[model samples]
Target: MNPMTIHVKQQKHDLALAPSRVVFYEQMQLVETFDDQSQCHMLFFYKQKYLTAVRTTRLKLHSYVACAFKEGTVYESPHPFLQALIETNIPLQKYSYPQLKKKIARPYSRQEQAKILTFFESFIPKKQLFQDMKSLFYQYRREGNMSAAYRVIRVMRDFAPNNRFVKEMANDLSYRKLANLYLEESQTLMERDPLFKEMCASFEDHQRLLEKEGRWIEAYTHQLSHISNQPTSESYQSYRASLSRHFDSDSRTYILEELSQAIPSFQPVTEDLFHNHVVNENVNAVARLYTERELNLNEEQFKQVEALLEENRFNETPENLLPFMKRITAQHPDQTRKLLDAFVIRLLETMELEQVHDFLKAFKKKSSLMRKVERMNEIHEDLDCMQELGELYYGFHQLEKSIECFQMEMELKPSAPEPLRWLSKVYADKKMLDESKAYQQLCVDVQKWA
Candidate 1:
């Protein structure tokens, strides 16, 4: 329905003589009316819930009507809010009294605000108006009264028209509401309700809010969608200028297609962006790419490797893990230490200890890895690596080899309790009770001294 228009000159004049001022924006609905006896009333719903009703003479009706979103309410009042009821001085000549009278739902009395709201409820969106009336209705309806709720529903539903908010709410309320608020109604009718430009602005606002909450993926997805759907506005020119910020646009296309299609006269950015590279998923391919200097590992590419590693059985076939360890260490040794530990621990977690010895034997047979392991300072002195190797030997009944690791651990550092502790266990496993007791006493002594 067409909203009422307030006569700003008359409202400004009224503002001077008023004793109270009530200013509100974000209008939900408005109506001006005259009863059968010509007693005029105006109702205004502001900020989604504030409903102000005022009784007035028909002489100054234009000032009682609604205005633009920034319109204010200035009046003398008993309490905090201004009250007005409107059914006259329609914003446009299209709405006449007889035409409005046909739309009224029921008989109206002199002082019945409830019936009065019902009479012209068809002029407003049913859901929003009902919600407004609900705030008002429940004030009268007490103690979780179903009857009052039902009664209020029945009264408003009979007259409330389908408001845009209620209608678009079925689709998507947030998008529609912001669309209507920012773009002119005619601008939005171009099929994409937000018309691309509006969407860019809204997305930027939404992304900042998402970023404040540390939702990186959600914010990135929004920017990605904005670029994907292909908005042509200069508002998104800065976004088009940097196409790979949120994603691997090199993974998308060599050229920034959105900027390529922009209107040269309107777009702020005149040049198109071109990036080149492939996100290699296979670890071997990635290693080659790094060697050739054709690609680099980012968090996204690293995630791809992790996902690929998750799918493989590192314990069942040492081929994938063994080569992967070799390739990563060769391609990016500095970066692969933590990754290698993760790979080793994952394999050990799933492999039987007895098979680990065979797996390690097969692993060491890879000449490339043998060379890398011999020269690699990465895990050379790592105590965790030695301890894992020692445990693997102990699991397979290689007592002497396990004892060698424990002895190396004692020599690798001063006198760690862990090596002493392991030495005690290995001796006990060998049935040398005297040696075991001696190592255990040394462990206890070390623990106390340290």
Candidate 2:
């Protein structure tokens, strides 16, 4: 089979106005079209998609792999690279790069030098590609080839979607002959690029045309996506203002529903959704948000959650209310303790020792908390539970309560030495030297008997 020929066919007249078109032919038949001119490939059509066999030096034995490029992203099949070649129209099994040398062994042929040059230049670094695309964009603009200029800018936009200059270039192109092309490309790119999408929506022409065409949902989506991506106060205020200016109450509600759906992917959106739900005092939504994740709520939001917990106190479970209660502990100490009191009681009923200890250890021991742990003594009155509760109180520096628990445990099992040792430690912590010595001696006597 003859080698495939790849070349560009430039129009003879009006170089600035005409586009440079690249054509690929295998045995004198055109395969497919490519917008970017920098890619090296042996092109072919198979399975109703245009595929290119690109040279890859990364592979150990293989010279090339088949892949398809779309919108600046590469798509390669999961089939083994070798298997993809077998399915392709052209075979690239023998097209490997020559061994690289630091110094020339002999004068090389032109074909060998060209192959080496292409090999070295095949994989362009992302930063370098971005720079080259920007340079090409300016070159195309200087020649008044807006079609070619926009194509280069599109790739540039992909490289640096949030770049100010790239965005300006896009805006400049939107005013020229490529206005429709700019809008069309933006519509495609906006699906993936939030910053670019935000830029497109910011354009007056794009906004006016979109609304004029009864595509307000798309416009709303662009704004919502912008807020989701940015989530700054200014962006959110602008979104709210836009909603008030353009949308009715029903439309606003629908847009809010759309915003709520985006919560899982964009946490900032979740923050907004949570704010709205708290403002409306939607107990179920607020409760679900608590269960979803640990939210970083502000002071005002924490107050709102506190109010919600207070309002729903009659019906909600301690498990459902504890997270919000725990978060607002500093702001609403009384309310947090009240809910935690109930939560501790629930854990005691289940005898979930670890969970109960976690809650108790999280906060400083309040008078109400001591009363709550008394219920734990009421629930589990065995010698072991008494010894455990004694240590728990000792950890909180409640020395009197610790001694009380240790005395009760000693009464329940006079032979047990554990509570005697704990009583000694607790009394010493209270700076009661005489009591510490008494209990320490009792522990020694019990161990000696054993």
Candidate 3:
């Protein structure tokens, strides 16, 4: 080893002690130069976030890694070189300078360099896990088990609760020390538990694997299985999340229905799982949900729902607006039908094609909001939602589908020129001149007949 040049080779371990104002540095190092020799003692410095500070501690000739006590508000370090200089009262004029920078680790193998790199790569996202890791790291550090310490410290630097913790851990987790450490098995009894490793595999880990294997259904199945054992609101929430992630409403419904039947009590976990999970996500599913029982709102709330819908659209809402309407419909079918029709209309009316031509189509297919309106016609036999829908279809240039809707509307309200007029436009678009002219003439005839 080169003679002690009063410092060690260091790198910047970007860690903040406080917010941005109080930062820390690490990787204390010493360099030997060929030209001359001077006292080199500085290591770490701190600067908060981005603000310029006059007294900011930047790594310079005076930096020091420390262990000290405080006489008052200020701290004092007990580093050996610091103590030597302070006690001896060494003058700056006597200090000699060196030429070439002393290179460290040239003698180590590539494997050693890789191990040092690995230390920097390890980090845990969970604060608690990091803290636990640090506790383990310290135990190994004290025992001079540098390999385990490297592992633990690597995780800490990545996921430490704060930057100060990082700087402190960095000093102990120095790359220099890592060269001396070698990998070995854990000796502690707690770490010896087979179940511990199994438990360490988080839901995220399992999900990642399943997703990578294109087994979303398996992930969903796993969550369902996990919920069966745990049986908590959170577990069920995870189950719901898995359902959302893996399956569309159709598949989700199928999976959920099967799960509900298999686990009799799964249905009760959320009072309105269909309305909550299925209806909101699937438009066609909402149309099918008309037969199910509602849960919360009363008849009086229908007026409020209408007033609320009129005031501001439920464009961005968190409340279970769909199920709340379901509850209202349970009480007042006629009024609820009207309000729901209006609500669905508002969404459909605004569902105009924006930049993407398929935006409205996507929305219509996804949320089943338009299906909700169709259900209103089923309940009341009054709101001719098909007429409005046909117009919407025509607006979207879905000619054949528009004609179907208009034809359906005409069956409900015969002698209506609206459908005849739309059929004419669609035929024109299809280049069926005869049929287009025929409907065009029939539109005028219907108007006169009316």
Candidate 4:
């Protein structure tokens, strides 16, 4: 594109001229003027529109009179041709046919002039051209216009490929906002377009690559984060399956590192596997590693690890469970439950029934009775864990403890009549008729509620 130079000329006319004077000298054609007069008027004549004309003036008196002719008739001007022409010494009268013919012999053709007008029209008459399109787009956007914006952008993108104004209009204010919008709208596009589906598949490929590298923890974390940012149940399931396949030996450092980077919460069954199978095997080794290197575990994580160590006796030689346990316990309580249950089961299985009972009794006695009761209440709400603990107590012939467990279970869930029935039987066995009658009545009441 070549640079365009525009020459501007302005003149002030003092006399009011009659319209009949304007003419085309070449064609001898008289020009028609509208009845309405405007302070500012611009006329564009090109070769395509008309032919060149020449004008000659033969002065008769000091007060000048001029004749003009184009394609048709010759006409006279009521006022003088020159008033006060500004910016140049060129006389306004010199703009007549004769002078115009002398200056430029050939003018633009009609087609050329039409093209120029069309180009100007493309941007001008702002309401008809740019205003409607711009207003429609912005109005659609203001209405949470995801689909509309997508359509508009797709269409307008071609109009202004390198235009900064268009780019700014299309670009999202922030990546996070862009991410969310894409997440919400991409699914629909992906369904409609194979190209979009391919893009999604590419992201999944990245997840697969991470898993293949034995970075199961990182892979899982990334998958979760991705899901949180852009939810898709199918993608989540695929990612989980991939993580499960890749997960092998527990590497606390690797898991922790990945957790820090990908998921700060860092509570996964994979982490527990690492803690129990890997870190527990060599407590000193794990502790030394933890202390020697930076541990990214937050305060909660540190507490979790400490609790795990205390409960599991990982501090013992050949199996330092302290750090791993601490880390696990510090995590979300729900996340820690499975590991805790497993640890408790293993601890009980290793010891004799009498020893386990004795330990439980002693531990219960040492801890605040109220706090222990609250903790029991918590466990009791979890039917599976509650049943496991109840059965354990029953195995030891701790009738009172067994009854207490059933009572707790009933308290936590009044809807389930089984616990009340069991409690009644326990009371009957102990010959506590009052308690038995009360539990039996409670069962009847619960059954009625059901």
Candidate 5:
């Protein structure tokens, strides 16, 4: 079945007037008549007087018709239909007709006033509108008309939810910001209103502004208080998680620095709050904090944090570690080296011996023995460092030292046929015939494999 088309007709003389009828017809046969009573009622209440006759004829009548007509000029007078309109309007407005009339009489409540103000709000210069609203709200506040002020605020909130003006009012008067107001008023609003949460989440900017004004404790306390109240709140949790992930390193460092000042003495519970609840599972901000304050941490506490990070395989990048190294080294050079070595050894211990050896070979400093060996190996014409050392020892007829060098060379490159052959020759020269035969047999075996 095709949906019925609605028709509407409006009176042209009065800008405040509405449609005459919303007609539904099939093939020009009037199947439905939504006459003037219903149509006029809808227009009056919605205050949509700009509607034309043609426009009105296109409307679909709804249950809101009575409520919409309650304030109409002819419709406002007492009649059975008007009484029904009042009754409907009252429940929808949550107030009596007299109260609504009184509200409408006020400058802010006038339909013309609202329309003029709204038009100016849209098309007038923003600064002018902002000033006008600011003055209006303040005047209402001074006159002890909080409702008027609130209405003005609502308009301002619509225009700029995160405006410094709105924030200042919320801060100074403890007026629940629009975001918090929506959240406090309705669970449905909290669930459905993304703008509300976004506005509130922008409090981080407010926090930073407070910090820049050197209100560290105040900023810290405010954020902590806000977070405490909303520990499990999704918006709050997501904000913190995003902060940890997206903030620049310096910003994160600054936040941690402020946090240290804010909570200098670690309460076990507060520490746990940071580790288990606040810090995201992916980013190790808590561990970074622990590392930053390691000097203040006892050995057991340090170990606990370290173990937790290790268990999770938390790898701090060089950018994170370098500053920490600089700081520790500046404080205690000797202790820092020892500490670093201990950590390095621990990391090495977790890997295979060959992997550890390979890591050391790659990482060894230019002056390091392994680096010297590597450089010498890279030169095609050069003997191994061990071979050169062995020759020096052999010049003194130190057979044991020479044998040790040959063994070291063999261990260093087991696949190298030259090292094995040299080892067999050394053993033979030492008059150790059995050792010579064994070394020669190993050389033959390695050659076959090669």
Candidate 6:
């Protein structure tokens, strides 16, 4: 069936204005007639739902037409529809819905506002929607809802795609002194924005000015503020470098003590402070910081820790090795296994066999298992390792590794039932039921042939 369309006409010139006449047409036939623009809006805005309601209630035309044309009532409670209408107006001047006119209007959440903006994009005319969304973007900025304001820019981009202002809102907010607002969208913007270069340029400018005036303590405090605001690796390094250049040992300790007393409630601060401690070779302080948060060591830092461990013959206490091992395990399989091997050897001196088995199970050995499988394949040139390794991976809930191992086994030993059966189970666990059934059939065929 052809969809419905609404036509609205108002008395253009009159001594007294008449109500706007609205007509609904379906398949080129006049389906309904009304004198309310709001009803006309319902047909277009709510679209199919309101149309479905109209079709279902056509038998009671008198009551249905009367109810639909009422001043502030629609299909649902007028709050949401009124909110939608207010959004349609962009700046949301006056309420068309009488109930909302006198009530205190609660501002919609960022999520709700995004939904309304999305709805506007759906049915509103392209030119008008663009203007309305642009107005909304400014409104959000004026209201200090920077996160939602940035999201409005995204919505505008989705609609216009090549809009110059939308592009500028994202790329040029730094020049507009709205970079902090943009950073609230995600702090990774510190790392991503080339202008900021992971450090607030304005903060750096202030620090440089203070230093030139011989206000070293004030300049150093500005550097700390920059770190607190951004907490990026670059900002932290800048802070440390500035501190080292100006402060003697006593002064450095005093300033650091003040920093510890005035720790900001940012998780990134603690993480970066831990890194700073590591760089200064403050071993006891670094150990104490381990209780606060996990360390996010960069490649250089990881290599330093790895070298330190190698110097100690991987015989570091398990508690000390565990943190670095957790973060680097995925990328450093050999080192992780060495750490694990050290842990097992240490635990075996006091721990029972069953206790050791449970402890080993907790640290999933995916990378090590894959490495072992590859080493075995390199040495023996056989498919025997495939089934065992695949099952090991599957037991650890590492479906991707299990799939890789099973596939290699299936290719190398097509007549093997184990790989077929294991692949079926792994795929089923992964929610690929069709592939699971196919593999299950393959497994049955292999078993029958055997």
Please, what is the whole-model Cα lDDT of each candidate in the order they appear?
Answer: 0.44, 0.51, 0.42, 0.43, 0.44, 0.48
After superposition, which runs of candidate 4 have C-alpha atoms over 4 Å from their true positions? 1-161, 164-189, 194-221, 224-241, 247-253, 260-285, 288-450
How much is 229 displaced in model 3, in angstroms? 5.6
lDDT value for candidate 1?
A: 0.44
Worst 10 contiguous positions by lDDT, candidate 1: 8-17
Best by lDDT: 2
Candidate 2: how large is its RMSD?
Answer: 19.4
Question: lDDT per residue, candidate 1, 1-450, as tens digits?
Answer: 112223212222321112222333212234344434555545444222224444454332122133321353322232112222122222222323334333332332111233334423334433554565556445544656433333343334433435443343323442454445434634444323211223344666666755664444334335545654665566365555444554443322322333333332322222222112223233443333343333345566555555555554243344345654655555556655555645545544555444433444544333433333332224435675776567655654567867987788777755678888898999998999999999899989888989
Error of 6 at 268 (Å): 11
Off by over 4 Å in 6: 1-215, 230-238, 247-302, 313-317, 320-327, 349-357, 366-450
**Please, what are the lDDT tens digits per residue for candidate 4 over residues 1-450?**
111111223245432222334332211122222223522222222211322221222222211111322222222332111110111122223143334433333343221222222222221342343343454456556887555544444334443346565576667563345435457756665554332243356557756655564434334544655664564547644644554454433323333333334443333423443354334554454454454343455565455554555564532531233344444345344455555444443434454444433444422212232233334445644665654456445544456667767767777776998888877877888899998999899999989988
**What digit string (tens of lDDT, one per residue) describes model 2 on residues 1-450?**
112233332334211111112221110111222224433333332211222233334422211111212111121222111122223333222122222222111443222222222222334344554554565566666888665566556555544578898788778835465556446765664554333343555545555655664444445544565565556667666776777665554445445645656546556556766776777676666766755655666677767876775666525445555554555564456546665554554545444544665555555545465555655546455655787777766654556667888899999888889999988888887789899999999999989998
- What TM-score quantifies how close candidate 6 is to the native fold? 0.27
Q: Model 3 over residues 1-450: C-alpha lDDT tens digits?
A: 012222222233221111111112221111111212222222221110011111122232211212110110111232222222222322111111111101112532222222222221112124443444455566676988665555555445544435687676666535544423322223242143222222345666655655664544334445566666666676776666655553455545554554554464544543444444433444323323332433334344334445555445545431234554444445565555556555454444454323122222223232344453344335323345777766666654556657878788767777888888878888888999999999899889889998
TM-scores for all predictions: 0.24, 0.34, 0.23, 0.20, 0.27, 0.27
**Tens-digit lDDT track for model 6 on 316-372?**
345454444545665566655665454444544444334444445545664454344
| Superposed model 3: Cα runs more than 4 Å off | 1-220, 242-258, 263-272, 275-284, 287-330, 337-450
Better of 2 and 3 by lDDT: 2
Cα-lDDT of candidate 2: 0.51
RMSD of 1: 22.0
For model 5, the stretches where C-alpha displacement exceeds 4 angstroms are 1-274, 277-287, 312-314, 322-342, 345-383, 386-442, 445-450
Question: How many Å off is the CA of 66 in candidate 5?
Answer: 42
